[model samples]
Target: MSLHPVVLITGALTGIGRAAALAFAHEQARIVVSGRRAEEGEQLAAELRALGSEAEFVHADVRFEDSVRQLVQRTVARFGRLDVAVNAAGTEGEPGPVTELTPERYAAVFDTNVLGTMLSMKHEMHVMLAQGSGSIVNISSTMGSRGAPNVSLYAASKHAVEGLTKSAAIEGAAAGVRVNAIAPGPVETAMLARLTGNEERKTAFLASVPLKRAGAPEEIADAIVFIASAKAGFITGEILRVNGGKTAS
Candidate 1:
């Protein structure tokens, strides 16, 4: 058995998830990275392997329960145990006002963000409960704490994630598992690029943030690594904001 712990990170192909994979790899943890993008996942796994860490790419669509269960089971079968999991796979739907939003778009966001995170946590917790120790980090957003225009459905879904994280953390604390959340501000990722393709809108969003700049995916990954490490053993049910001070306003 490997001396280091095993960490399974969802959405590990790009952006924050990819950054977290590298961060954990630096910590020498065995990494099991899962996502629908097989090419990206395999590419990332290769990079982690180059860093002298064990990495496996598992393709999963977190919206389905079977995929989530399979992800956990495969991690255990590969590394013999699971010590940490990061729920970071999510999407921002079409840019439209609440009244103009379609039910289908709303459902899609909820299915992937809210329900997917829940399923990841459910299956990971089942493994952790059997092991009796683990750590989980749910990737939330600043919108989770407050409402934002043109993203009502996405906001609502993240709020649901926050609620789930807190409630589940309380329940899992007794099992020696720590559950925490990270609410990141606008980070310079492909997702944010899609969110602010318009120059005027991008400038407006940047002006609203106190830092006057976007964050790096690595920054959010660092926060996840901190919470997943032994340093945060006593920290549970807490939401760490990595929003470049955006929530202060």
Candidate 2:
């Protein structure tokens, strides 16, 4: 076996996931980054390679069970084993009042956020259990712990993710596979660009945050890297909030 570990990150083509790929690459960890965007995924893989890190791209859509399974299979095939798994693939559906939310919108959010994470973990953990050691970090949102206006669907999906994290951790403890979650606040990403239309809305969002600023993707990625590394070996089933104290208010 190589001295470096194998790290698999989903949704690694963009946002926080992209930052994490770079973070792990810098640590000399062999990386397998999976995402639906072939161009961006391949580009990131090339970037990692340029940094002298062993990396590969596996195209996958987490919402589909088969695609998620194939992603893990490809990772194992390439690296021979998986030491860490990050389920960072997620979606933000149309925001609206619960009464006005359509079944289509609800299903879309749940399918990608809840079902997607579950399927990815199921397949990843299967391999981990057999190896008798692994760690999983699921990316959730701060809204998972608190209710937010006009985001019931999204909030619910993240809450489900937290629940899955806890339950999986309990079950995997005996197998030496740790499971946890990372809940980030308003990070400077394309996903939050949708909420940056008006100055008042933007300020209001920041006002609740004690840091008085939006979080950077790199910051969130750092938290994830710590939780997924050997440093957090004794920790499991925790939702490490990287929300800039927004939930404090």
Candidate 3:
């Protein structure tokens, strides 16, 4: 009902999620930053309010259904309605050869990256469908679209996210709620460092990209804001890639 949309971001304490929060704040959108860490969450909220965006920090762990459900409910309660939801909570699971993979490792990654996104979508959609207008963006990776060695679980999890986004989009389209995902390649985030693990490996990974460089979080954030904007009203079920030409070839 307001031109300045109420925005909710999960895993907002770091990486691309944090950047998206700042980007939306610059647009004067109301914000709710959700994370497992209350201290960091509250700090981010204060920072957003400092930027002139009305903000609140709602602690949430997407791996749990109740936490995610409470997060969406609290956002609606505080903001009067849900407008934009960004699912950015993900993990780079322990990398290993397929022969060395285990069930525990698989669940650890899927719980946060796959199941987490699903639960967030499930709860967010309930509110958006009832309101009859909203947008949801889930953060994915180039690995979602292509295969990668060692990080197969992470790749698979993101692939699941892509499917969830498209399925959710189709379900929400007629209800005036749009769902989409952003697939970034070699983003400059803590997760990237953890995945690459060393300078040499990081360099090699960047070289694989057609642009020969990693993308900044803010760059991906811009792409997300655009898709979440009314300018992209007709765009839904899209896995918008923001990977410096990583997939161009």
| Top TM-score prediction, candidate number | 3
**Model 2 regions more than 4 Å off:** none
Residue-by-residue lDDT tens digits, candidate 3, 1-249: 368999999989999999999999999999999999999899999999999999999989999999999999999899899999999998998999899999999999999999999999999999999989999999999999898788899999999999999989999999999999999988899988998889999999899888889999999999989999999999999999999888888
Point out the higher-scoring one by lDDT: 1 or 3: 3
Query: Which residue runs does candidate 3 get wrong by more than 4 Å?
Result: none
Instruction: Write model 1 residue lDDT over 148-226, tens digit each, in one string.
Output: 7898988999999999999999989998989999999999999888999877888898988999988999999999999
C-alpha local distance difference test of each model: 0.92, 0.92, 0.93
Clashes of each: 1, 0, 0
The C-alpha local distance difference test score for the whole of candidate 3 amounts to 0.93
Please identify which of the two predictions, 1 or 3, would achieve the higher TM-score against the true structure.
3
lDDT of 2 by residue, 110-201 (tens): 99899999999999999999999999999999988988888899999999999999999999999999999999999989888775667688
Pairs that collide in candidate 3 are: none
The superposed Cα distance between candidate 2 and the true structure at residue 123, in angstroms, equals: 0.4
Worst 10 residues of 2 by lDDT: 193-202
